[model samples]
Target chain A: MLVIEGLTKRYATGDLALDDVSLTVPKGQVMALIGPSGAGKSTLIRCVNRLVEPTAGTIRLGETVLTALGDRALRRARRRMGMIFQEYALVERLSVMENVLSGRLGYVGFWRSWFRRFPLADIEEAFRLLARVGLDHMVDKRADALSGGQRQRVGIVRALMQDPELLLVDEPTASLDPKTSRQIMRLIIELAKERGLAAIINIHDVALAQQFAERIVGLHAGRIVFDGPASDLTPEVLTTIYGEEDWSATIRKAEDDDEDEPPAVEAARIAAAD
Target chain B: MDAAAAARAWRPPPLIEAAWLRWAVYGGALLYAVLALGTLEVNWTRAAEGLERGGRFLGAFFPPDFVTHWLEIEEGLLESLTMTVTSTVFGVILSVPVALGASRNLAPMPIYLFCRGLIAVSRTFQEIIIAILFVAMFGFGPLAGMLTLAFSTIGFMGKLLAEDIEDIEKSQAEAVRATGASWFQLLAWGIQPQVLPRFIGLSAYRFDINFRESAVLGLVGAGGIGDTLNSSLDRYEFGTSAAILLIIIAIVMVCEYTSGFIRRAVQ
Candidate 1:
């Protein structure tokens, strides 16, 4: 569970990236944050991990005051949360197994990690996670050599290796193709639910969010404008979240027929532009 | 149409507008050249006679008295190789922390400035000059040459490695941090991978440079082939001097190829 109150972030450049934003993600609940570019969606997600220090506010992850914690305590607190990046930021030069096993870095000693002598249990789990993700054959391959989808799968397995209580996924499907995007979204949602973990997925695709999320939060210009069940997110609400645009037409185009156009294609195009 | 074409046919003017200043600069350079050339003493006859003497001196080195001075050449070459290897190993090892400290992205302000200051001091003096000072302090041997090469290597390797660190993809580091990794873990996983290949390449290249420099360090009694060459020249043993020079050239060529192969392999 994650609770955020009165969170605000003004960067050193004086850009108000997040303003008075507040939200709660219940246990085993999936919340998809949808908004246009520069909508403070990423700022909200990063604030949870204290990756970008909030200018003001309180963030509590199961009674740990993340904002008040010192560096060492913060690192300990961070182990409870897993973050997935848009770029699938696995260490490219490291092998796939190494990147996945790196999830245990918080638990491993420096010398153990420096020599890459991860514990046997961690290695087994990493291999199991790789198998779960269907990348068992490519365990020794360098991360950079993998396809984009494979790399994102590696990212997923890496996050799962953390045994995290909360998942913070930022644009998990932004880089993949339409079919791959749906598959990735399905994988993330299914995995999060199976693990009984609360997740805050920052996404640009409204259709995918509606399909995958139980609750949706829309951010616009550093403020939360909409937060409710996905069914309540009507075309007008989407227009409010995205701005005055041809939403009905796009959504209609997306849903009229699968042969005409897939929701993933239309949503992916809009997401790419964002 | 002709009038319109003429109006649109404008070209940019020359960058240097001050004709007078340009002419003054040219005139001053010309005047300095003429004055310098006029003031120089000419000894054309003496030059001709010296050329004939140089030809005879070179003739003495025709066969390169290899059989006689082979042992001395071997000893000098071995010393030079030893100095190069030892200095490169120590220098590269010492450069790691200095490079980490010098990287603005990684180190704190005070440490960055301190490391930069060290680099500045190392780079300010040439290796031979550093060797001279060390020889005075440590007394004429390979120790002085090794120290000089190591000091110089710190400057070169640290500066380049720091630059490489600064240019690494920041998102990778941020991802590592978000995972709750400790500072050291983040550096090992995120920063090290991005810079290690380049760092290895640079170290090999520095080895080649130190090898060439070590050969000459002995000119100041810092201990290498140059000492033998210097002694040979002083005694007017052109054959021995030529032999030492040839051996040095061969060693340098070998080091060049070895380092090049290493650099390519690492990449």
Candidate 2:
């Protein structure tokens, strides 16, 4: 289980990106953090991994207290948590295989990694993960040469290569098209389940989060305003989270048809439902 | 309707808000230019006589004699080529650490300031000036020229490379760091790949620059083709001097093309 208590982040520039927030994510659970822009969603996940240092908080993953660890200990602890970026931050000039294998950097020695002489087991696992993601054939291609969806797949495989117990995904589908966003979200959800890993995914699309995540945590201006099951995300709850607006179209009903509808028609249907 | 049309008429704001101040600035600049030009006293008659002598000097350069001091020219060219290659190798080897330390995003404040200060000191003087000092200290040879060029190369390469490092995509490096990679691993996987192309291009360009600078270094008793050209001029052997000049131009052209090819290939 990942437990966070009194998590707060105040940037050096005096922006209070996160407030006194406390939450817990048990193992094998997938939670989606939904908030408007500047809602501290990204900061919350980053703080879990200490990518953004918290002003005051304690983050415990399983038995380890993450915030209090020293440099080397922190690095070792970071290996237990994988982070996925919105921009698909794969070393652009490196081949896809190298990018995927970079996750094992903490495990391998410097000389071995420098010479590209990874152990046979690590290479095998990398191949397996790539094959699972359907990117086995493109391992030799440069990361910059791949399309948006393909690059995100490489990013996902790289994170999984760490064999992490927890995944910190930041705006995973923010840059993708609607179909690709749903597909990527589904893949993350499936992978988390298959590995029995807990995940905290920061997403902007409310319907997609409701569809994929078991629980939804709504952040508004650095504080968690609502935390409930996906079914409890009523229009009134969304209004409280995102400020007052007509949110009737945003809250999907249980009987709503979840088909691969075109974006215009989907918008029209939501408008009609409203 | 008249008021609406007037409101729609938009013009860019004046650069200087005060009209009088703007006119005063322009008027002062014009006056300064006129005064500066007036201070330059021209001796037209002396210049006319010198132009005739200059024609005679130019006439002596025709029918360039490449045979009479061919051995000296060959030796100077060889010495310059050796200096260029050796200095570039050593300079680039030393520049990598300095570049890393100078980068604001990579190094701590003290190291960054120290590395930047080193670059500033190296870049303060021209190559010819540094060559003169080194020749005075080391007793006149290609060693002084080589050292001078290498020192100057550090400033050029280190500053440019640091700027490139500072401009790299932060998210890429952050991702690598998040993977629990060591600092060295972060450099190799994240920073190096992003800046490698520019690094190679800068090295090639620096090699070309060092070659040109080495030739000029010879004028200060640091051995290169410029020494041969200087001696030829002292002896009033304009033909031999012109031949050496032609060889220097040819070599510079060759270096330019080769460096260009290497840069494009790497990219």
Candidate 3:
């Protein structure tokens, strides 16, 4: 379980990224966060891990207060939370097995880990996870040699190797194709379900989030505008979250949208429709 | 809109407007070149008179006298090799910490400034000038040459190594941090893997440079092939001097090939 209270993050430039936001996730529940660009989605997730220090907040993971901890205690608390990145941030030159083994860095001693002398049990677990993701054949290959889908699979397995209590997934499907995105999403959900793990997935695709998550939380301009089941997310709620666009027309346009148009042209088309 | 009103509204765009500045720089460079050319004096008659002596010297250089000065050349070549190996090893080892300290992304502001200042001081003087100072202090031996080369290597390797560290993918390091890795462990996992191959290649290149410098270090009585060549020239033994020069060329070519092979293998 995770609990957050009165989270506020004001950057040094006086820009309020997150203002008085608060949320919670019961154990084994999958929550999807959906929002427009610069809607404070990333700031919220990073604040949970204290990667982005909140100006005023209290984050309690189970019994531990992460925001109140010191440097050494914060490091210890971080080991319980696993983070997946949009870019699949594996050390490029390291082999797939080494990258996986690095997930256990917090548990192992510095000298042992520095020399890459991971314990036999950790090594075995890494191999088993790699085999589960069908990457056993390429265990010796460098991270840069894998395809995008394969790399995401590796990222999932590495996060799982941490044996984390909470998974913080940031845009896991942003750079992936539709089919690959679905597969990655399915893999993460199934793994989390199997382990009875709690997860907060930051996603851009509303339909995919509705398809996968049991609970949906919509954010707008640094505030939570909607929080309910997928069935409760209506066109009116979507308009309130995304602004005054016609939801039905935009959904139809998205289905037939060509991929060749630049982002500026797309913005102009949206404005014209509005 | 009326045509006259549209024409009145139109305004020409602003230009860079620095053409005069550019022309002034060009003119200054041309004047400096002309003045530099005027400073060097040449005497054609004296040059002609020296041509006959040069021809005789060239004639004496043939067959190289390698068989006669073989012992002296062997000693000088060996000394240069020792100096190159020793200086490169010490220099690369010392450069690692300095490079890490100089990386703005890694070290605090004070440490970064201190490391950068040290690098700048080492790079301010040429290797020959540094060698001259060291020879004065250490008294004209191979110690002076090795020290000079090592100091220069710290400058070259530290500057490049800092750049390589700064250019690494930041997300990789952030991922490591998210895994609860300590700072040292983060460096071992995130930074070392990215920079190791470049570090090895640079060390090899520095070795080759130091070897070449060693051959000329003896010119200032710092002990190497340069000293042997200097003595031979002083005794008017053109044949021995030519033999030493050929040997130096051969060794340098061999080092180049070796360094290239190493860089390729590591990559």
Candidate 4:
């Protein structure tokens, strides 16, 4: 479980990126935070992980007051949360096995890790995760040689290898095709279900969120504009969150049909441009 | 259109019309010339005397004699080579930690600063000066030359290796950090893979440089062929000196070729 209170973030230029906001993610639930670009989605997620420090806030991950704790305590608490990145973030030159082995780094001592002296159980778990992701053959292969989808799969396996209580995925499928995106989402869903772990996903795709997420939260201008079950996130809610009804309403209506397959790549490009 | 085109066309009209900045620059240049002329002496007689002396010195270094004193030549050459190879081995070994510590992207600011400062101090003086210091401290041996080469190699290779680490993909480092790896583990997993090849290449290049430096280090009473070279010069045995020069040229050429091959292979 994670609890955040009165989270505030301001840039050096004196712009409030995240204003007085609070969020709670209950254990073993997939809560998707849906928002347009620059809606402080990434900043919020980074703050939760303490990758970006909040200007003012209190974050409690289980019993640990993450904001109040010192660096060492924060790092210890951080081990319970595994972060997945859009770019996969796999060390290109390291082998798949090594990347997965990296997940146990929090538990390993510095010199022991440098010499690859991870515990036998951790190494076995890494191999088992590779097998779980259907990448057992890629154990010795450098991460750079893998395809985007494969790399993201490796990313999932690496995250899962941590045996984390909570998984944080940021734009998990942003770099992949629509089909691969769905597959990644399915994989995340299946793994979360099988492991009974909590997951908070930041996604740009509304249709994907509808397909996978049980609950959806929308943010706009550093505020949560909508919070409801997936079925309740209608065109009106999206229009409200995005601050423009016209285009999104039409697009939402279009996607409402069973035959509609949204152009994930083109939409991603347009979103990037905006 | 013709009037507009003519108006757009520009040219330098006259020297007098040159901008004040240009006149100021020319005036500064004239002032420099006057100052230089006042301070410097046109000593053609002394210059000619120096050139004549240089030519006489060169005239003595004719017909290199490799056959005579072949035993001494062999001994000096072996000592020079042993010193060079040992320095190369020791220098590369020492540079690893320094490289890791100096990399800004990988190390803490204090550690990075300390490593960089160490390298800076190492390189502050020429290798000969370091050799002289070592010789005075350790008392006239090949150990002094080796230490000098090792210290300089650490400075050169460590600096280049840190730069190479800085050039690595930041995303990979983030991935390691996200994994909650400690500082050393992060460097081992993320930074080492990216910098390994370049670091090896840099070490090879540093070895080549150290090889040349080691030969000259013996001139300061640290042990190598340079001791023989210094004695040859002292005795005015220019033919033997020429022979030593030939051997040194051959050694330099061999190192250059080996380093080139290594760089290409690694790259």
Candidate 5:
């Protein structure tokens, strides 16, 4: 489980990006953090990894207190958590195998890692992960040579290679088409379930969040407005969470409102749209 | 009435203001114009008067006196060429470490500051000034010229190499760091790859500059064909001076072509 208490982040310019915010997730749970722009979603996710260090906070990862740790200790703690970025921040010049093998760098000896002398076991694991992601044949290809979807798949494989205790995905499906988004979401949810890791995702698509996560936490202006089962997320609740009065008008603008269609059918309709 | 009030509230004071700037530019220009008119007029008149005398002197230069000193000139030019080549190699070798140390990406704060300060001190003087200083220490030889070129290259390449370091992608560095790489490891893997091509290009350009500079370093008794050129000038052998100038120009052109070819081949 992860515990955050009284988290506050005041940047150098004295802007309070996150003010007294706190949230928690139990082990093996899929929790979606939903918010519009400027809701501090990305800031909150970065704060979890101390990328955006909080001015004041108490963060507990299981029994380890991460917020009070120094740089070295924080780095050690960060190894237990895998962070997947929206842009899939893999080194473009490096091959897929090298990028995945880099996931084990924290565990590898400093000398071995520096020389890229990855252990045979680690190399085998990297190849296995690549195979799992349907990129076994592309192991030697540089990251820049891959398509966007292939790169994201590689990104996920790299994250999985870390064998992390906690999985943090920031807008994983934001850049993908609706069908691809569903596939990515399914992979994330299924992988988290299989690994029994804590997965906290920041999602832009409401429907994807509702379908993929058992627990949905709605964020509005750095505060959680709704925290409950996905079934409890009604149009009225969405309106409250989004801070909009005529929320139905937004959903009504969708050309297809066929309730009987499968999720894939809805994905098809969205794919055909602008 | 309400609409008028809203319009009045919306108006800003001003977007562009240049009153003080205009006055400052005008005042500086006026001061420079007065100083130029006072200081340069006499010099210009003297230079104009000397032009006729220089033309008469140049008229005698066509029939060069290469007969008496052609062998000596060739020997000295060969020495200069050797000095130029030697200095370029040493200068590039010396600059690599200094450039890496001064680069903020590759070095820690203490090392970066120390190397940057050293480069600043080295670059403060012209190469001739440095050669003069070295000539006093080493007693009038090619060694002095080599030392000057090496120091100057360190200064020039160090500053440019640091800037190239600053321009690399932060994400690549962060990704390397996220792997929990040590400072040295991150620099080797992350910074080196990003800056290597540019660093090589800058060093090649510096070699070209040092080649040209080496040809003239002997004017300060640092040992090159410039010593011959100066001697020729003193003996009123303008034709020999012209030949030395032509040789220096030809050497520079060859060096330029060589560095360009090597750069393209490597990069």
Candidate 6:
């Protein structure tokens, strides 16, 4: 379980990105953090991993108190949390396999990582992850050579290679098309379920968040405004989170999607088609 | 009609807001140029006589005698080539750490300031001046020339490499760090690949520059092809001097072409 008590992140420029945000995510729970731009959703997730150091708060990932750890201990703690980024932040010049193997960097020595001499089991696991993502053939290709969806797949595989207990997915589908976004979201949800990993996915698309995540946390102006089941995200709640807008269309669209075939089956069918 | 007139009436804003100030600046520059020209005090008669003598000097250089001074020419050329290669290799090796330290994003404030200071010191003196000092200290040999070139190369390569490091895609490095990679691992996987192409191109360009500078280093008694050219000129051996000059030009051209090819290949 991940417990955050009074997590606050005030940047050096004096912007309070996260303000006294406290929440707990049970093991195997996938929570979607929905917020408007500058609403501190990214900061909240980054604080859990200590990527953005919390100004005044306690972040406890299971038994380990993340905020109190020294440099070496912090690195060891970070290995348990895999982070997926927006725009698929893969090293553009590195091969897909190298990018995937980089997730095991904490486990291996510097010389091993430098010479690309990863352990046998780690290499096998990387191959399996790539194959599972259907990117086994493109392993030799540079990260820059892949398409948007393909790069995101590589990013997902890289995150998974860490064998993390929690996945910190930040705007994973922001740059993707609507269909690809849904597919990636479904893939993340499925993977989280398969591994029993807790996840905090920061998303902009409310409807997608509703479809994939069981729980939703709404942040606004560095404060948590709403935290409830995905079904509880009504027009009023969205208005509270993202300010007054025509949310009827958004709410209606989410309802319309829910009435269709079960998301898992739909995702499987799409995967097969692909 | 009003819209059409408005569309046709656009003009860029004046750079200098005051028209009088702009005209005054222009007038001042023109006045300074005229005054500077007047200060030169041209001697037409002396210039004409010198031109005639220059024609004779040029005539003496033709049918260049390469056979007479081939041994010294060969030795000087060999020394210059060795200095260029060894100095370039040593300089590039030393530059890597300095470049890393100089990069603001990579190093702490004290290290960054120190590395930047080192680059500033190296860049303060021209190659010839450094060569003169090195020769004075090291007693007029290729050792001085090599040291001079290597010292200058650190500044040239380090500054550009640091700038390249600073401009690398931060998101890529951030992702690597998020993986819990150690600092060294982060550099290897994250930073190195992004800047490798630019680094290769710079090194090749620097090698070309060092080769050219090596010839000039010999003028200050730091051994190179310049030594042969200087001695030939001092002895009034115009033919031998012309031969050496031609050889230098050919070598420079070859270096330029090879470096260009290497850069293009890497990119």
Error of 3 at B71 (Å): 1.6
Models sorted by lDDT, best on top: 6, 2, 1, 3, 4, 5
Highest-lDDT candidate = 6
Better candidate number, 1 or 2, judged by TM-score: 2
lDDT of 4 by residue, B1-267 (tens): 688888889675866675897789899999999999999877999999999999998888898878776777788888878888888888888888898889886689999999999999987989999899999999987889988988888888888887888888887777677766666777788788887778778877887887788778878998888888878888888889889888989989999899989988977
Question: Candidate 1 vs candidate 2: which has greater DockQ?
Answer: 2
The regions of model 6 sitting more than 4 angstroms off are: A257-274, B1-9, B17-24
Better of 1 and 4 by lDDT: 1
lDDT, residue A4, model 4:
84
Ranking by DockQ: 2, 6, 1, 3, 4, 5
Docking class of 3: medium
Winner on lDDT (2 vs 5): 2
Fraction of true contacts reproduced, model 6? 0.81
User: Chain B TM-score of model 6, please?
Assistant: 0.95
User: Which of 1 and 5 is the better model by TM-score?
Assistant: 1
lDDT, candidate 4, equals 0.82
Tell me how far the alpha carbon of residue A108 in candidate 1 is from the true structure, in angstroms, after superposition.
Answer: 1.4
Residue B67 shift from truth in candidate 6, angstroms = 1.5
- What lDDT tens digits, residue by residue, belong to model 3 across residues A158-239? 7888899999999999989876676688778988898999999999888778778899899898899999997777789888
lDDT of 1 by residue, A97-178 (tens): 9889888888888889999998899999998777777789899999999999889989988888889999999999999987
Where's the lowest-lDDT run of ten residues in candidate 3 chain A?
A: A250-259
All candidates: DockQ: 0.67, 0.86, 0.64, 0.55, 0.36, 0.84
Give residue A190's lDDT in candidate 1 (0 to 100). Answer: 77
Error of model 4, residue B201, in angstroms: 1.7
Residue B242's lDDT in candidate 1:
82
In order, the interface RMSDs are 0.8, 0.6, 0.7, 1.3, 2.2, 0.6
- Looking at model 5 chain A, which ten-residue stretch has the lowest summed lDDT? A251-260
Query: Candidate 5 docking category?
Result: acceptable
lDDT by residue for model 3 over B10-120, one digit each (tens)?
877535347787778889899999999999999989999899878987888886878788899889888888899999999999999999999999999999999999999
